[model samples]
Target: MPEPYALLIEGGTIVDGSGERGFAAAVGVRDGRIELVYGPTDQIRAERRVDATERVVTPGFIDLHSHSGLMIFADPLHEPKVRQGVTTEVIGVDGLSYAPIPDPTDLEALAHINAGLDGRPDIAYDWSSVESYLDRLDGLRPSLNLAFMVGNSALRIGAMGWDEVVASADDLANMRAMLREAMEEGAIGVSSGLDYPPGAYASTEELAALTAEAARGGGFYHTHVRYDLGDRYLDPFREAIEIGRLGEGPAHITHFYHRQTFPDGPGPMLALVDDARADGQDVTFDTYPYEWASTRLLIMIPPWAQSGGPVQTKERLADAGVRDRIRREMAERGVLFAGRRAWDDVRIGAFTVPELIPWEGRTLGDVIADRGDDPVDVLCDLLLAEDLRVNQVTPGPWTETLRDFIRHPIGMIGTDSTFVGAKPSPRTYGSFPRVLGQFVREEALLSLEEAVRSMTSAPAARIGLDDRGLVRDGFVADLVVLDPERVRSNATYDEPRSYPDGIDRVVVGGTIVVEDGAHTGARPGRVLRRGG
Candidate 1:
């Protein structure tokens, strides 16, 4: 009578992503939505069938924080993510992206600062509004769905230049208008990188005013706190919480973790979050499962010396007096990799200069030792030569600290992975699988059902996606099938590009993108917009 279902996945242990226990069931798909989820005893007919016997069937993962916004345009296949069972990624993180630019110069300036994290792809910089940029993505036909946030840095640059001055009344008004426009163009929220320039110069009142506009549109505020693990460590967290209160919006902290230098560990840091929540403020956070953290190497420069764009910053780095001031400030404040770990713990993750390819994977301390020069001079020279386009990975975190945060009720997962260069962090390819294999199966840190919920339902709820992130009737058919016993991340810091093991198949919108542990070249992904 009725037409046969388009596809069927039968005889699998269905972990429905609601923190419930797994059950044996069969799932049917038709018109890109889940048609039925029946028990194994029920008979179902389909045009095609996948015998998912002895496997764990769950919803595909959602990456809450990612830097693949521009990189995806360069390489639309995005094998690194699709192979790891990721179906959606939230981009425009750390408040730096290429949308809402006022002019071509603003886009170029932002691209230069962002080149270390997102490589300078050969694609055209054709769009200036959030809607136009999202339309460009829709035409690219990527492998995973993409959702975006309006970047605060882009907002600041659009309203003002890269000067270190605070915002005036007119400046604040212009920024608010820009934020409202982006939200109307389908952005989920606004994000900020307070430690980086342009955004670093913004005052608390300025941030509150702009975030209030996002709140008025039913969007949240995501921020990478100003500082982590130092004498002034707690101040930044307090500032972020205060912003959410002042702006009257939900706040989500990106990459919330304790550094090894913290004397009391994550207990004190997480206590701050508890206090905020107890006071009736909406706050949540995400973290990756790794001991080393990665970011642009230019962040180590003193804020005073980084006023202008990359060109001016490079000019200052060439001055001896400025270099001395930077070194003194770093020493006095215990900045960079000083307090937490030695220079040997800091490795070069990526560089823009072709000659520096050999330096990839080498420690900064090792480079200084081989060059026979002062550490400060060596660092300044490298940045100047590379035009501030460099990335670094510093080792950090304690075992107890990681366990405490991951088990917290409001905690979710985010890779914070910058997918660029030859030696990117292994988390880019291994984050979700590592949590499943090491944390869930090997160490028993969390149950398989709870882990699935964190990767699926929790992130979906955070971004307000109603039709995805769960294995339910009428939901989008984005799912993963894996062998729980054999699932594990094979990527290492040395060889960071390798994919994980035990992912049998990955489906997006009822089409198989990865089958038999290999990519099938299906590009069914679309750009997701807020309230669309």
Candidate 2:
């Protein structure tokens, strides 16, 4: 007879990740896929048997927006994500990534620029093309699957040097050609971070052209909408929708939410998305259920101050007149990037040097008060000393309005989790559990099945993963077992590193990676690509 099954997990209520009501079932796994999903396994034989009594079994979570592209190489076990049952994470987001550089030196420069956001761990920068980078990740035996996207910054730097300029006809053609090659090399789609250059330098027309190429390859446009354009409120998102229309492809808005600082209400923004979908545009969005956001400290500076490259940006920071000019500009603006609403609530973290280490987890306002220095001086001097690699946490999505998005028809989950600091956003550690514990269990905002679908199938469908995000007889064996009543996020704004309460067992490729909420030291994650 055939070999006994690799694993048999029995006695759990299966949610199935289909948005339907769950049923009690047993699951059988063989090789790396689900062999059978049915009732009792009393007649079955297996190498290992798991008593899943009193637990709820569902597909492992899929995170749409992740900043762990470089950090995963350092911490191959990837404790924070696997422990939370994230079996797959989409990276190369926010118009920042580490492949298709065409120049090793430029790759190093981009790494330094992103260190504050993506973390500069002690790993070798070995590859120069998309295929090589994917191959390396595949060989690394990472704890969770990584899906790569070709960022607009990497595309722009490859076609034209890192200069601020609207694309010419030839430049646009070159970028399109590069995108085609990247997609062929298994890239998912095009990603743009309008706040980060030289991708930020792209005009609406230029973005339309590149995304059109992606559309031809069965890809979509994932964007951090341009915040500096038009009214700086609804205008930025309007540009994103218009780009998708012009390019003729699906467009996904990432990290979407509502903040109190906006002059307009969340109603208009929600209606905008609804109207677009009703009018026959394939549109969706994702938001993390937390009140704090984290990212690189350099994003606070204006694009003009960051025009040419990292080297030029550093030189400008050293100039006394330049600092004074930026100070006046900040005064006129009266707020930091992304409409954070206030400066003092901005806490700086990820300081590497010993002197700056003491400043870690402290607010810039407190530092300015102690040093008797202007905000600009403290910012510029700190950046100069740190070599442009600092991270910060700022006030984010309002909880009152967040509830509205979480219940929207097209709303999904994307933690937008930054990985550089000891004080990363609590969502990094608690996103899935927070939704399960607070929104579903406590507040009854949405059903547990709906929340699981949002965390699993919704993102899988949006990002084009066919065999995952569901518990079926012939799907990949990425599953999680949890106590529904006890599941909750212990992570908070001040204490951001605590794991969730009730993740019992996590399986990746039919191997148990996490047992009893601890990593079992089995790394079976694959590097997910566009298609098989």
Candidate 3:
């Protein structure tokens, strides 16, 4: 019925993403699948063959938590991802996404909320429903495969207005309906941004109900938990545990970490995970390797103060009395910005505007000195101007903090970096390279085998990717080959958009998309769906 196809990736040492030691193997592909691997067969003879001697062949990297949502489609070349050997990215992260909006105003509000995925066109706004949004992805021939989580914020906007109060019975019903519809339309799961609006207004019961729907549809519940740094913030972790227990869906903790301010680091958090796992709840998580975290300037605003809508937030900034009150609350709570944290570790990352770009690689303290303004007022004004979509980075401890997660059985790696075409965070370009080069090859933090597994099979397994994240027969032919000794991420915070080095070749569905460290401009990737 269809034409026969074959290709051979010969002589590479395949890592296989199975946590097993690599061995020299020739992988064969046909009909967009691995026809044969590590065996002699007539199928190996093909019209195309790649000599990959001395190269590391592994399943293409999977980004478990990504913000590439619409950006990947907007810029199908998506060098920020492809150069890092990523073949599949799980987007719609941090409890924010573009689907299931209730109205045009709601959609506009969403676009303003996360400017990291900027330059999206209004014509791209044609899809209003979750199914239609996913279908839009189908028409775009992106460089990598994509999967999305139906955001908790999208559901809230569909159910209730962006108000600070609890939902009415009708509101709850409508929200649940949207969640159900999204899941049915092939969403892999539900992601909640507990720290952000609309979702911030949702109660634990609401979360439980939504997650239960995900479970019914055989999906996971991923969350950017409400808080991560202070005493009161630990309550959100507890809330997440409760959601896992109540929802009966696998709970995936997005951007898992612990602030240095805590006497205990990931120790207590890991213990909680153990306790939950022992109770038979499906609990897993992801973390980026860097010691710095990125988010909007609005994080300094007390959650209660931001409970009102953005209009009220802007008004509060204009009133001296209100501004002083907010400032006092931040001081009392030990909230810090621009590297002058009550705690010592916070740094600054890139900004939405070019003028702030000079501060991209510096500490928050340096940014404050450069601006010669109170960090508080600068932050407030930035939030107001950008509609709270400006980005900032906070410092973190790398050694133990990252090692603990990589060592954990259930933990995987994610960049947590938002994608905006070529104008992306360094993590988009450097995350996997840093893991392979700095962590595995240089510091010996992890064996090359372990590092590959964490980046590949572990995340693929977490998201239930079938016949993938492995170099086995009948599997998807998404693969990457690298010169192990030469691999490294060249993209630094100052030069955030640079591509990595030593990616020998990349194949998507058996088509060579990247050849010898350069993109081939191929569009062989697909829109992966749940249970498809």
Candidate 4:
């Protein structure tokens, strides 16, 4: 007689993550994959069973944007994401990753620059190659799967030093070779954050070259667009699509949102993608369903000010003349700059100093007022005082405009979750539930099946993962159980760390890692390499 199945889930409405309607079924799991989706009356026995009678069974969520490259090593349980039903996440986003930097000096400098966005974990900075970094995650027992991308910044720092210099032919060739090697070693694609140097220093031609290499390796280009380029509205997206066209590859825009500051409406912004897809360019986008956005405080400064890496950046922050120039340039360029309104609308956190604790969760405008100093002085002072490790939460999109992106056909979900400081973005804790509860259940923007499809199979297809994104037979068992009526996010802007409700259980690789909305300390997650 054959042995009993490893686990059996019974009496649940299976929402198969393929945008299919709900149906009553019994799921059988054996050897870490779904063995059968059987009828309710079928006789089955297993090592354990979950009575999901009143719950919805679906594929575990996949986050297309995550900043857990370092924090996951420090806290392998990864409660905030796993508790929200995220079983796999794409790291090395925004053109900022920790690996593929052969230079230790550059690695340490990058760490200082990214401390506010991704935390400064106490772990050793040992690995330099892409394969070694993924191996490091495997050794530490990551709580959820991570897919790595070759950040253009790492490539730039490797080819040329961490300066804002135009790439020569030799430099471009070196970068393409580096990107090719990274993809060969398991990197899924190349990513760029055009606002962040030295990757930001890379021009359209340079990115197109790297994208061509990635395309040869069956990869795409995932970018945080050059928001300051062209008109600062549609032009950024236009550049992304043009890169895809020039490189002859797929382009995926991350954190696609409509801000109140954009002069045009969301319609024009979305139309770029529609037109691109219409022309067979293979463009897609991901947006979190929140009105607020968060990132490092260093983002408020210009890229030229951040040139020459962290040491030079610190020197510039301390220079009086540089401060005046920054003020003037910020006024002149309007680089995510809104003057006093920007300062007033901004809330900051992630202070490690006792003296700065009072400023956490407070507006930058309020701090400037209290200190009776210019906003530039206050900004420079805070950055210098904290060693350039402050983060900001600011008003980004209006809720109505955000809903338009959510309902778009080419749009998927990427929480853009930043994990640092006392007040992280509520999207970190609430993105999936907010969509499931508020968007799908409350507002009827789309059905539950469509929402799950965006979070699961859509991202899986984008990532080229064939085995883990569905509930079909022979697929890996990464599943989520939810109470449809009770599922909602308890997290908000003022209270950001709260866990969600109605997520009953989560499974990763056929093992229950989250039960009753809490981490069960199971380390079943592995590094999911491309085509592995």
Off by over 4 Å in 4: 334-339
lDDT of 3 by residue, 220-293 (tens): 89988877424643666778888978888889887787666665667888888889999888898888877656
| TM-score leader | 4
Backbone Cα, N, C clashes tallied per candidate:
0, 0, 3, 0
> By TM-score, is 3 or 4 better?
4
Q: What is the TM-score (0 to 1) of candidate 4?
A: 0.98
The candidate, 2 or 4, that scores higher on lDDT is 4
lDDT of each: 0.84, 0.88, 0.75, 0.90
Question: By descending TM-score, how would the candidates be arranged?
Answer: 4, 2, 1, 3
Candidate 1 lDDT (Cα, 0 to 1): 0.84
lDDT for each residue of candidate 2 in 1-532, tens digit (9 for 90 to 100): 7677899889988888989998888888987788655766787889999988999999999998999888988887988888888999999999897878899989998998888899988889999989999998999989889888889999999988788887889999999998999899889999999999889999999988988998898888999989878877788889889999999988889998888888888898988899899999998999999999888989888778888789999999999999888978877776652232355788898998898899898887777778887778888988889999999898889977999888886888888877777798898999988999889999999998999999899999988899999998889999999888998999998999999988899999789999988999998887888975
Off by over 4 Å in 1: 40-43, 228-230, 335-341, 352-354
Which is the winner by TM-score between candidate 2 and candidate 4?
A: 4
Q: Candidate 4's residue-wise lDDT over 69-159, tens digit each?
A: 9889998888899989999999999999888999988899998998888888888999999999999998988778889888999999999
135, model 4: CA deviation in Å?
Answer: 0.4
State in Å the error of residue 355, model 1: 3.4
Please give the lDDT score for candidate 2. 0.88
Candidate of highest lDDT: 4
